[model samples]
Target: MKIKFRVILSISIIAVTTLMFVSCASDPDSSGLEYMPDMYRSPAIEPYVDYGEVRGRENKDLKLKRSAMIPPSGTIPYYGTDSATVALMMPYARKANVAMKSTHGMYDAVLTKENEYDFALADKNPLKLTSDNMGDLFDTGKKLFTANCAHCHGAKGNGNGPMVVSGAYVGVPDYANLTNLSDGQIFYSIYYGKGMMGAHNSLLDKREIWTLVHYIRKFQDTDYGTSQSAKALEAN
Candidate 1:
């Protein structure tokens, strides 16, 4: 009985030791031989992770499908209950030019054969700058621009951003040189993108884009968005 008990204990120890070895891999990155791998790795779909060849198994259907899908058409996101804000957040009326499908990767966007960028030239910014709000608006614009535009457009809007300096990108036009661009034209370029710049519609809302329009104007004129500038704009 004693010998049998000792043998059972020895077998149990050996089994556990073997399991430890089987579970480990020489490659430090690999977690080998996972027991119930489903429990260890979730089956839930994750955006941007290629699950096409998960765990040495090929899934051709999944391989063909994009993990990150564009939002369905006509889906409006919930923006809170301010009438002005709601109006500001409403879907843009303008459509991308058909050529943008090839030039700007806007294949999924609603496209028109017409020169909509020219049409956008008539679309004035709805976020009217006032002396009371210009301070807050400019502040918000600065933050937004710093996060999204400064990398490529530069902090001073001189087209000498870190990306240009690093030789990663080129042809970022200087705001100082773009005096001919209408406010609406600048907004259109930012919304749909121009040349190498991709569409920012996905990243920024219409209000923010307009705010950026206001901020970018300051790059062209030092007095832009000032109380005096607001009065000057009203006169113009």
Candidate 2:
């Protein structure tokens, strides 16, 4: 009977020891047992909210000045995941603009030496020149071009697309002709109107226009007439 009692007592002591050990363990709340390091957590959200607010404020300020925003609910596209994917996949896709169709109709005056000259192409659509393997700049240029210039320039830099031909536009210089102009010249023309072209500096920011200038220069050789004048002008 004493032996059995001693055995039972030993078992009780073991159970109490285990309970004490468990109780002494670090508290889940204090020990960060359930907490995760930032590395394990999601990436910090880009400040889209602040951006939206700032953009909204800017829009209000510029409402009376020439408005550049694409009309709400218009077919003028906002960038999408597909745009980025397509840009990555194909050079042709990267040059295409989302705003082309709308920009086609914005022209009220037509200036054409012949029915062949297309000015709407330059007037509406913006370009996206991807620099030498500068992917981030390329992506940014692509988005800006789509947002501001696609309406007239078409999806590709090729001038044969819907926007220019379908709308009330003429003298739209094709991308081929535009390429002959150097980056500085292109920026100059965009800033100060040459010929019938209006100044886009008021509408597009500098980097945005410069990026488009490169994109337009890319297709200018294959699409339209070229001039040594751009070369001569550059030399001078």
Candidate 1 C-alpha error for residue 209, in Å: 2.4
How would you encode candidate 1's per-residue C-alpha lDDT over 1-236 as one tens digit per residue?
A: 99999999999999999989888889987778877778766788878878787776899888857788767889888899998888988999999999999898887888999998898877878898877888998999999999999999999999999999999999999999997788889999999999999999889989999999989998988888665675338523
Task: Give the backbone clash total of model 2.
Answer: 20
Q: Mark the regions of model 2 whose C-alpha exceeds 4 Å error after superposition.
A: 1-133, 220-236
Best by lDDT: 1
Model 2 lDDT per residue over 1-236, tens place? 99999999999999988867665536654423223444433344332222222211454443344324434432423345676443422211111122321343324222233322132233322233223434555466668767755665666755444567787555656665554445555655554445545556447755566566655544553321123335322322
lDDT of each: 0.88, 0.47
**Predicted structure 1: lDDT:** 0.88
Candidate 2 residue 226 Cα shift, in angstroms, is 23
Best by TM-score: 1
Screening candidate 1 with a backbone cut-off below 3 angstroms (N, C-alpha, C), the clashing residue pairs are none
Among all windows of 10 consecutive residues in model 2, the one with the lowest summed lDDT is 91-100
